[model samples]
Target: MPLTGRNFLYLLIASGIYFLSARFAVLLFSLEPGNIALIWLPSGIGLLMVLRFGYWAVPFIVVASYLANSAGMAAVLSELAWLHTSTAALSNGLESALAATLMRRLLPEGLQSFQDIFPFVFGVCLVSTAVNSTILVVNLVMAGFFAVESSWMIWLILIVTNSLGILLLIPLAQAVLQAWESRLQMRLGDAARCIALFIICTGMTWLAFDMFAGFIFLIMPALMFLAVQGRKESVYVTLTVTVGLTVALAAENYGPFQLQTDEWSRLYLLSYLYSLIVLVLGTELYQRDLLSEVQARQSWQYRAHHDALTSLGNRSLFIPLLENEMKRAERMNRAFALALIDLDNFKSFNDSFGHALGDKVLKEFAQLVRKNLRDIDVAARMGGDEFAILFPETPMSEARHAVERLRKQVEKLTIKYHGRTIQFTISSGLAEFIPHEKHTSDAILGRVDQLLYEAKRQGRNQVQA
Candidate 1:
């Protein structure tokens, strides 16, 4: 929708979801940042909200912050707390809005597919998160609200988690939306595969941590399998589940990438990067599938309008063109000509030799007829050994000249078939429509067809206008 009251309501609902989700993330994953949380989802979801709704939703980030911040609603009643929370919320909202803005400017296809994935990964994930984290940290330090001892750690955590949230989580949500709109169709088999793959990956992750620490890369193949075999939704669901389980396992000191450090930032960075692989590859697969579908559609359309043997416009495409030209010439008081071409003794070529050579002769003869025509002229294969040509805005003299020139070319043309040379000639009839002649396409074609038979009756190797 539009910028209406209902949209504001949607903004509120989205903000509420962001608030709750961010709070839940903080409660589960906290470090030395004093409840500042590692996986900062509010910012990522804020970006999604602005992209989904409009920039008008940015201010509601404050509402999300107030509801989710460790400092409760009562603390916000105080002047100092209110100022601090407002600053943080504004910083979050502005950075996310900046991400949406920069992505709009940078991504060529505007967040649609793999085409725009690079810009989002760089602009929204890395650059936007870095800006947000830096600003928030500097603000807290200047305001003396946060201790400066662990400022670097806080910044690093914010950057990685924020990037993870945007790259990993946002795509999951985007996939669901695409599936809802029927843009990305997910089959039951694909969903089943994704679930099974996730289970297998989780088990492997558990085993790798328990037995072989070096085998931590086991989830890669599973995710890659899902990305290759599934649609956008299945790839997204598989990645999300894998990330969640791996993070949970690593956080609890069960996974292999568990460096002995107090902050498990390595897992965050590595897991995010690996998940990045899945997202990009999955989107590329989707793009290829989409391109294949478009090509298939275009192929069908071409076959529908064109002759297979000659690769020329067929009857299905010719008549409408004639009608359009008729309408235009009638309206503008201009002139156009229509011609029908029939090759003499064409059946002898097929019967004496084979249909293959006859087809080759026909194709060559069609090309001969098409020689030296104006851009607005149309040539079509009416059927076996019969063709139609249309010349828009041409008078009878030029129309007759074009037909005679093509006939002479057909006379000289020769097709070589298996050490034998097949030679042929064409008989054609030309019909011109002046503005004064109020004729339909059928009437003109009928008259031209009669002229063609007349040329044949008069002895074949000639043109009659």
Candidate 2:
């Protein structure tokens, strides 16, 4: 399936939201969470890209990391802003791109479970963070942000904490967002239930706030709803909790419990950043996982009904299609036809030229029929040496013209076996199904089979109705 422009926009928006939330978390807490390192930063976004478009994670991670480092350096360090920005941007962008690529290379050949996520996060984000942070601190000293004498200590601390934080919090944030999204999807197509859940979850989050404790615990209950019911419920739960916390915190600051300037800044920025990043990355990953599931299912269905060798519709697929056409013809009082084509003297060709040559002939014959047939017409291999074509909404006269062309073209198929050129001709038996006049698809097909036998009897390389 094609990914639309809207899909790309959605992915971009989701990643942007997550990056903003990460920044918010830093600003509000005044103390950055230790676990941001664990959750996998842009990797979550990259994972989503791989899932949705299958090849977009590389660019998405690069841009996201670059933007994140640029913004973070500008906010936290004011002096030598350009120097910090350049160094940070390079570290961040390279780390994210490399992480995405590395994870993609190590990908398991199946859907991932909750258990698989932690290892992926550790390997990609945590490892990348360590390397990137080292480069960043080294650059900082080179650019004189810190003296060469003290840079080592600061670099070590920065690398350790940042790497650990990324590996921890980023994964949690991603998981929380995913849980919430699953809750939301469960209520899909039910506007009333969705809105109701939204209101209720919001109310609950509001009631759960305490003076010293943060609203972080609210993510737990919300995740429960998502796990049990799906994304629709999770969205309501997360939204309600986040909104309630925001309102509660904001209202308190203006009253007798007014917060200091730094505190207020921290409160708003912290929760906002954390929520945004987790939500966006989480939702994007969830959607991508859903897309992957759907694609796998469709692929399985296609494989089940198609010939493994040639990818042409197999007998299993063709039979039902033929039946459908027969029904349509009955309704319209029109006539359609089925053709049973056989390669003349196929056994002799197989014996003389070898089975490999016979197989080549079969594949070439299917290809020739594909070129000759219209999209509305379906051709399938019944088995070795036999093929069938079902012409929908076609009368006897039109069917004959189409089948004759196909027959002529197939006769021209040549194969090289054992360094010798071998050619073959085909015979076809065509029969028309006249709506209610023919009671069953089997009956019509049986008539075509008889016609095929008669053609073979009259001598190979002929079509008889």
Candidate 3:
């Protein structure tokens, strides 16, 4: 119950952050540190939102903004406060929600590290900004500022500038929150990168003359972080930059801080866009690197155990494990069987057709035997046209039954190579190894081989026990 409650609280916080962030972006363009001092507390709660929740979070955000604006409006003008507040919230909500939804669809497959940050930001944040900014423009027009013809210029400026503002804040927000929470696995190197990101964001916030220049310088450090750092660090870096920029602008009494409504809105959208791109790119790069490492290791491991052609476990890995199992079974006073299977008329088929057909026949025969075995059972190709199964806790009689089934399955299998179809059967030998038997692993394998020879001698396609 406690866990559930904590989770609920977390959801509220995250959703609130998402909502407020969108709302704030629409209203002020920039989330001035001063303006958001009280409101920004809700942002961190989003970590608890299930991935599915990022979709519905937009509307809640819009309402939060409306509430904030209403409170502001009431503090000053009491008349028509409700109407203005609702209009503000709805416009922001529609745009932000649409963007978040689009992002959810294009969301990367797995959440890795810094590499995925950029793409995620571009998809979720930039797109969201575009949507929300458009809605903001429409709302202004609806308020009788102008018709589409007169408002088109303002709309374009609002969309582009605000989107940049939102993009800028994303990294700063990510850095502060993610770092404080220790969400990213950061060693000395990651810490250095985060600090570097802070410096760059701060410099841009303090030194840059125009929005475009601010973004260009600010995003450079972010791109660097995304390309190299892991997920947590990348987000941390983005967040920190965003927060720093907002704080700086507010301190200077610029744009959102001074209630320069248009500039504030532009900055807000840009900040969100920055955050979205960084998040996506960081995630992609990190996951891609991890997947590559995994694949490399798996390939190395497979090469050790499996036949290159047939993908059946080869002699090196299979024989030793089988021997160990046999030893364990003997100590427990249990019985087990090793069955040796040899393809009959294999050489003849190869002579009549080709070595390609022979290889195909061997692979098909291995598959057939593998399909007949239990999941716990180990099947291996001892050599060309030769295979074996270690049947744990089985007696001689049961082993013989298994061998018969295998033979029948093999007989049913056919291989086609170069349009020539050839059928083949296998002869199997079932041999039991008991505790009292004076047999080494080699001796047991040799016994099965001898039985296999006997089966071949008796006839080409029968099981000999």
TM-score of predicted model 2?
A: 0.51
Candidate 3 residue 153 C-alpha distance from true site, Å:
31
TM-scores of the candidates in the order shown? 0.61, 0.51, 0.45
- lDDT scores of the candidates, listed in order: 0.75, 0.62, 0.62
The per-prediction CA RMSD against the true structure, in angstroms, equals: 16.9, 12.8, 14.5
Tens-digit per-residue lDDT, 143-186, candidate 2: 56566876565554444434433433434445556666666343
| lDDT of candidate 1 over 1-465, digit per residue (tens) | 377888888888998898887777766554432544545657668888888887887878766875576464234234466666777787788877887888667863445655566677777678888888898888777666557986887787777777766766677776688788876555688768878887877777678768886555777777777666667677766666656555555545535665566555554545555565545555555665687789999999999999998889999899999999988998999988889989999898889998888888987876666666777799999988899999999999999998898888878877778898778888989988888677888899999999999999999989999
Over the full model, what C-alpha lDDT does candidate 2 score relative to the true structure?
0.62
Candidate 3 ranges beyond 4 A from true positions: 1-291, 414-421
Query: Over the stretch 34-142, how does candidate 3's per-residue lDDT look in tens digits?
Result: 2333122222222113233554555555566676566754554446657766876676556555544554566534334455455545665456556655665666565
Please report the candidate that would top TM-score against the real structure: 1
Select the stronger candidate by TM-score from 2 and 3: 2
By lDDT, the best candidate is: 1
